[model samples]
Target: MNIDRDARLEKPVITANMTPLQWANTEKYWTLYKKESRISSESDRTTHSLTCCDQELRDQLFSIHDDIFEMNDVNMLKRIKNMAVKSESVIVAQVNLVRSRQNPEEPIRSYYARLKGQAVICVYTVTKK
Candidate 1:
């Protein structure tokens, strides 16, 4: 799945102010792109992952991290994910999820899928008692 060619896999430019849901969507698309493209090599995956972001984000990554160039795809993703998620943003995501509702004309399956997608933004940490 070429990011440019596929609408579902289009590259999302990660900005500092982007909402948690937006970041989740971006990550979801990136994962889909990786799966569909079958990029197996760590080097190739890292290259593609780095290129998927906009130049601004790339510049920010470079500026913030000294070893970005030396990082693999998983580490790069972790870095980006850390930048994207925040405590306040998690509350916002929860609010958005709570506000989400199906349109009157929307099918149940589509509505359910949409809710599921929105739920991704509301990350919950599970702890065993």
Candidate 2:
């Protein structure tokens, strides 16, 4: 069978569920959202990026407000933020521990060993990059 394809058919169709007002606002929000500051920390960046998706769009995306995907995303973001804050505290503690002087009664070998271990842990666990 031979059929003539209308050129208009090549264009995208607006989804029936989304209204014109919602679409316009979403487009405007997206443009403004992209101009926001870029974060250096991975966790901060993730939080910032996720927040850019406006609530209106989110409501349109998931029929249920308590959708599993939404819940998981929120939980993951919270975990990332917590990890970043905790890692910062850990790094500071390790630095202080490494800097403290050994007691007069402590052996020089033991002091060096403790410092080396702390240094290794800091280097492996709290990398900023």
Candidate 3:
């Protein structure tokens, strides 16, 4: 299963609650995304269903395509929170699983950032091995 010589390259892409325009509200937002550096990973955390209201977020979780969406609890939905998506020295990444379907009981990784008034989520999911 040596994957290093696949002769394929993945195009670099970014993700957020809505579109690139929506994520660029401030320099801080860009900085935040740079930290996470992946679109699907960021979407799983900060947005309900990887989208806000009516905006259709990029479905980077799947190589094919999906419209899977998730929502926060009423409490999390109503509160103001700061969010950041990135990898860290201690953590490899924020969102590990961005798939077309998920079990409701599956645990998704997320963090509460107070400044952005939202929880940073990483729906790192595992499939049947």
Question: What's each prediction's clash count?
Answer: 0, 0, 17
List model 2 lDDT by residue over 51-111, tens digit each: 5444643444444334424344345434323322224345674777657799899999988
Candidate 3 Cα outliers beyond 4 Å, as residue runs: 1-47, 53-57, 64-84, 91-129
Candidate 1 structure quality by residue, lDDT tens digits, 53-92 = 6677778888899998788998988887676555356678
Residue lDDT tens for model 3, 1-129: 433444432322333333212333433453444344443553444453223322222333322233233334222222211121222321222223122233465444422122122212332346797
Question: TM-scores across all candidates?
Answer: 0.65, 0.26, 0.17
Candidate 1 off by > 4 Å: 1-16, 84-91, 103-110, 124-129
Clash total of candidate 3: 17
In candidate 2, what residue range of length 10 has the lowest lDDT sum?
7-16
Residue 65 lDDT in model 1?
93
Better of 1 and 3 by TM-score: 1
